[model samples]
Target: MSEVRSEEEKAAEARRGPRRGPGPGGHAMGSGEKASDFRGTIKRLVGLLRPERALVTIAIVLGTISVVLGAVGPKVLGWATDWIFAGIIGKQLPAGVSKDQLVASLRAQGDNQKADLLSGIGHLVPGQGINFTEVGRICLLVLALYAVASLLSWLMSYLLTGSINRVIYGLRRDVEHKLGRLPLSYFDRQPRGELLSRVTNDIDNVAQSLQQTLSQLLTAALTVVAMLIMMVTVSPLLSLIAVLTIPVSIAITAVIGKRSQALFKEQWKSTGELNAIVEETFTGHELVKVFGRRAETEAEFARKNDQLVEAGFGAQFISGLIMPMMGLVGNLNYVLVCVVGGLRVTGGSMSLGDVQAFIQYSRQFTQPISQVASMANLLQSGAASAERVFEVLDAGEQVPDPATPGRLGGRTEGRVAFEDVSFSYSPDKPLIEGLDLVVEPGHTVAIVGPTGAGKTTLVNLLMRFYEIDAGRITLDGVDIRDLTRHELRDQVGMVLQDTWLFNGTIRDNIAYGRPGASEEDIRQAATSAYVDRFVHSLPDGYDTVVDGDGGSLSAGEKQLLTIARAFLSEPSLLILDEATSSVDTRTELLIQKAMTDLRTDRTSFVIAHRLSTIRDADTIVVMEDGRIVEQGSHDQLVDAGGAYARLYRAQFAGAAVDIEAQDGMASVS
Candidate 1:
């Protein structure tokens, strides 16, 4: 009798579904440890730019020159302001000690010829108001200097753009190459979405930060240093006041940046988590719909999205305070310098022009300090991204291909042996320990067992997808590990239950097994697998495009295509992993007929859940708890009434009941 679900139970299921939280794909990303070696990460990131040293150096030189020119422009403008004041005031130069000081200040501004020329002219034009001719030349010189600085700034930007592009291009390429070398085990522990985010999103963030910060780094440093010296040269009193803000601003930035840096890392991780949820949710859309889980799925998405929003807000808000705080400190210092400089000018300790230049230098000094403070966030984010990329590059690779790889020459006899082989997915728990198995050439070995009986592990070891912890698996008496993976796997064909077909025509997917196969060869293989039954009915026949993993085809039709692929490969050893378990009766019969035809001279290992399918197998190896408990022909196993007999009888009774139900439904209809 069926038990009825309560209203509350039904509502609970409607609200929560089977999975109310993140699925298997949304595992927390990263090692969750802070980056201890920030300097090392920076050094390694800079090392990637080593190839473009010459271009980067040119950019640095140009940037430094532009910053120096910009810094000096304000001082020159101050001199101009003083000259304008003097010209308007009908210069009967403020005499005595002030006269000596004014001349000395002019000479100290540099360009002795220009200063001496202006000083001699000023005496000649005393009480005559101003030297218009000399003023125009000074103004034009200042304008030309600024023009050259502007030109160099543009050129620097151009050079840095080229250099950054080349460096980032190589970085992306290295990341891609690293993915190929990473071991399958590395992928097992990490979510696919997180790895993808590192490759696409993290590296992109690094590139953008470098583009903005790398070009300005030299300019900011040079500006700060030059401005500091100029400030001290103008008047050490004001210089001291302006310099006081540097340490204070740095302290504030450090505190705020430290808080935001952690938030940025979390933001990136939350982004990956969100992406994982989307990937897993959409990939299993069919399953979600079948179980009426749309509401629960949306709830899960909302939870992940909210996490992303919170992380983003924290990171941006904390980092956002840096520029404003630094600006406030700088503005306060500016007002202090103004008051002190004005008082010194009135007391005649500093000339009007010198006081003006000191004010300009004070402003210049604080600009770079603010820029550096703000750059703290950029540098930290870039460093975090670099560390992520480097982690992938540093991950352990598959045991390097054999130094001296062995080969499987000509046609192999398919003699596979697992001699006392011990293996485990992890060291803490062992799956198969000291197991022994041997299959002679041209034999059909059916592996029958309950789920989790290490049925797939045996094939995984045989194919060397995983290395055995102890003992050795041999193909034709040669250790499979001795041969290159390509050389060993080339002769083995697999047809798993999940058919993998790209978005291409049927011919292309079938020909994937043999890239060099001819049209005739494909047709012959398709005919052998009975794939032509459906292909010929299509409008475009073999050319019909398969989209969304062959969504248009039935499960049985996809299986036939995979079988055709295997047939075309003409492999000596075939591993059929539950290949026909999910098909209907007619499709199963067709697949069985195709398998009988294809297994004539080839060695095959068939993994099956239904006992009746393996009745004709040459030998049945029944497994229980990762150990083989019974081995014999079907009749022998039934006669013995062991694990295999019990499994066979249960499947038989189930099949009979299913047939009875189908007949009753047909009668009622």
Candidate 2:
């Protein structure tokens, strides 16, 4: 069980650092755009509570009892007041006229007028007009009702807590499940912080509102209806006076609520904007310092921060106006009820007790109106959050898996082919068209070209990360589309330029690709990838913990761990995408040796950043503008004097110049 913390303790913990979770905190809205379908969002939000109908129904029944008991308490008190008045007046009572008999007589006469006046407290007294003991009993009954209602209120809250928690849990689980089904392309355009926010912040907002506002909303509604009924039961004349101000209260609320709704939308949007800015800046703090952009970044942050403040102020200030204005309307209605009741009392048609109860009932009626007025902001905020969460839930998912997927059992020979494949990130601008490439088994194909040469696009198609616009890709003489993604990807291994690592021990990270791999298997793979060299130096060896994205390790070490992970997976087809681009010269040499050994018996496609690294590849395909310009061995490409030769010569010339500059410096020293 989680120990509940005090507000101060929670605040202290918050001050320490960011909260740990599956996703980053702070920014939550995937887009700053306000939800256009307010009603739809609310409908979906309510639908989440369908599973808790039994609990909700019980809460409603109990809530109704509680509101009714509290509403009628004032009227019961009025009965006691009439008893005290009758006693002081020294009025003679009819013989044997018990409280029940008088109430029956009053109702038989069709005069609920004095029935409300004398129902519960009218009992014959020996010398007194009204019985004091009976008066005491009625008062005690009202008090008991109040006490029972309070207990019911507590029970209702307990029930709602469980129901609301389940609903929130379901919502979060849906989001987690949705994320797994979404395609990688969806994440490419989205900010990581914003997606994290949707899961963490937006859902939290919805949960908080449901927890805090749900019971109040139900109670306020019940109070309004029940109190109105009680008020009319007492005296319809004064009830009319109380009811008249309701329209005025509503008009005022509508005006203020409209402004608040609009402002609240902008407020949340501004909050999302601010969160995005903070996330981007903090995540790129090192880059900002390297570029000497601190002042400019601060200025940008201040501008967004200022917008958030202004929006927050507008939203809160407008919403805050609701309570004061509604209070004024309620007070005016109170005065009207009192004035009318006082006139009726003086006219002998109403008793002092009746007047008092009417006044209390009037306050009760308008109090809910005021509460609802105040709840406007919370409702609007919750609706906005629900919209954001629903946006993710409703987002387009990846292409569906085949109904009956083909199997890739045993080892694959890794003969890959692209047959007239065409693709484009955008429909209008085709990047690769009718592109056909075939790699025989155990051949290393090096894709070389200038930037935006459709090299990575080819890899994306091969992996089916994104579906091609036309044609097919095959592995081992089988169309990849016919196979399940799990089956196809199981045969392939990928190492990108940017390495990714989680918060775990080195052994755990390497074993991720092969969860069932034994300790011996992991160690052998690590040794093959040269990760064992550094593992021995650490006190914990493979048990050493890596921080965020393996920040504890150097970029080269992180890459090496990823390579070891791939090696452990034992993929038949390998892809090395600029795997050593960011490493030091010594680290690069080690990585090259490890990669060469790993690729010896597998068909590999190397997307090289440095031309020299792929000099020993079996084939080099030079591409530009989505079309292959030249294809041959390294020596064949150099001798051909085509696009491949030009690119090779340029890289070679740059390397020669760097060597000469280094030699000059060394000679001078």
Candidate 3:
């Protein structure tokens, strides 16, 4: 019963949307994680960008150009400053005196320091005012360079956005396809919510990370290089001082990032586990309430939520330290450059304008390094998500369909035969071994057994839901493995204990059994399955819309709708697995009659626990421990007093004895 309920919940969860809630620390869930194989995952992520290499290359070139232009702006402005200062000094000198005469006069007065300062001001006339015209030209040139750089940067961003979108689009498509190819066993082993996180949350994170960091990384790197070149041109000594901070920043980032990477990985893993719990709780809320486990559920949620918070806080705190540490190093480097540059300028080895320009270059040099260091967390988070997504993409898929798929000609005879079929969920724990059964065309076979007796497993084998470990199952003498799965399933229709209905009108739900089925055909199937009796009483009748959870409908009504769907399909083989188990007595009788009509010429496999329901079946196969212990007509089995007879007596005779005892006690009272 638990397994049955689990299967039902899985079906319902698959149809529903993911349940979302604020994660720990009031942030959205799945903020980020770290990859175990950081370098390998990063390499694979870069491989995804290969298709967009051309656009990426073009964007990089534009970004480089923009950075170069922006980097040179400070140097150009510095030249204008030198010009104005030279003019101011030259204007203070005698109107006709040359710079050489001015210096000679200073030295003759025994002012060697002043004479040296005067000599350092190159191209300064002794009797000239500030060159406002040249200064204006330089300002305009700086403006033009900035404007062009901004334009190119915008273009580069546009190209990168397009390229990134295309790459992510392909990635999502691939993941979707990979999901379709994966075996059912993979899904069985994984939680739906965890798998969903990989598909939705993790993939979205990867896209966002790439979008946020790719262009900025490129720009920051190029800016760093460009600023370094400008700084070197202005003053190599100060440039070298700025360069020293790089090693320190790298060391800090490396240490903190390594620790934070593990935490981020834990944070996302906890997010997935929490999501699975929430999904399970939400889907089974009614069951939880019935069992009065709401408090336990809440406690479990709190524990996992707390785990997520701890992991998130540790990861965030460690990664957050990088920016500030990098900033401190940058500030120290800036102070050193200032002191050195000032000394050089005062000693007449460097001009005031050159010192100012080098200071600006030094700031620019440190800024990109800081930006890159801060982005380490984002990169690690994205790499972790990419690895999770890659795991799904790398999972082994189901056995491929036959290269030359065998087809069942227009219609199938529905003669299913299992020949020495052996299978198991685990290598050592065999569930079905050497199981052999043959269902003749147009015959109804009832399979009855205790729970875990392989009743459903037998049907699953016939449907090829799972492959057999040895031997083969055949349909009309053709091996099932030789035919495509689609072809094999086309002839089968199933109505499980749990009914699955999408959010659609009754008419549409019925038509889903046979897509493109006409309205008259849908109504005919509904009438045959007893759905018409209640549906017509409703305001919308066949047009009444039902939700995915079978809105406002009784359990029996939901069961009937599923039977009507199977009836509409008119499949060659029908599987009724406890189809009437959930219905009341009257409803069950009605369903039984409908099923009897539906099964008229179709081969049917009925798995039931109710001895009364399968009493009239052509053959009753009693199974235990994955093997059929008894197979014969119902009456024959009863007369033989075997497993079937014992089961029948337990259901009917036991009830009779209990009723008689109650009557005797009432009479005595």
lDDT on C-alpha atoms for all candidate structures: 0.77, 0.78, 0.83
Q: Kindly report which residue stretches of model 2 are placed more than 4 angstroms away from their true locations once superposed.
A: 1-30, 91-130, 653-669
Q: Go through the candidates in order and give the clash count of each.
A: 0, 2, 0
What is the lDDT, from 0 to 100, of the residue 47 in candidate 3?
94
Query: For model 2, which pairs clash?
Result: 27-197, 28-197
TM-score of each: 0.86, 0.87, 0.90
lDDT per residue for candidate 3 within 257-356, as digits (tens), equals 9999888788777888788778777767788788888888788789889998998899889999999999999899989999998778766688878888
Candidate whose TM-score is highest: 3
Clashing pairs in 1: none
Q: What is the lDDT of residue 285 in candidate 1?
A: 74
Residue 39's C-alpha lDDT in candidate 1?
Answer: 72
Q: Write the per-residue lDDT of candidate 1 for residues 1-669, one digit (tens) a residue.
A: 001112222232333223223343334455436654567888988888889889888887888788778777777766676666567643654433443465577678865553443453223333445667766777887798789888998898899889888988998998888877665546655666677778888899899889888777767788888888888888888888988998898799879988888877777777766776777677777878888888887887798789889988988888889999999998899889889877676554665677777777777778877887788778777877777778888888877679998878877999888899987765765667888888889888999877667787788677766678999988899899898878888888888866778888999989988999999999999999889988999889999999756868987889889889999999999888888866786567667778988887888999877644577789899887568899999889989998988988877656746645654665576
Alpha-carbon error at 377 in model 3, in Å? 2.1
Order by lDDT, highest first: 3, 2, 1
Off by over 4 Å in 3: 1-35, 107-113, 652-669
Give candidates' CA RMSD values in order: 7.6, 8.7, 5.8
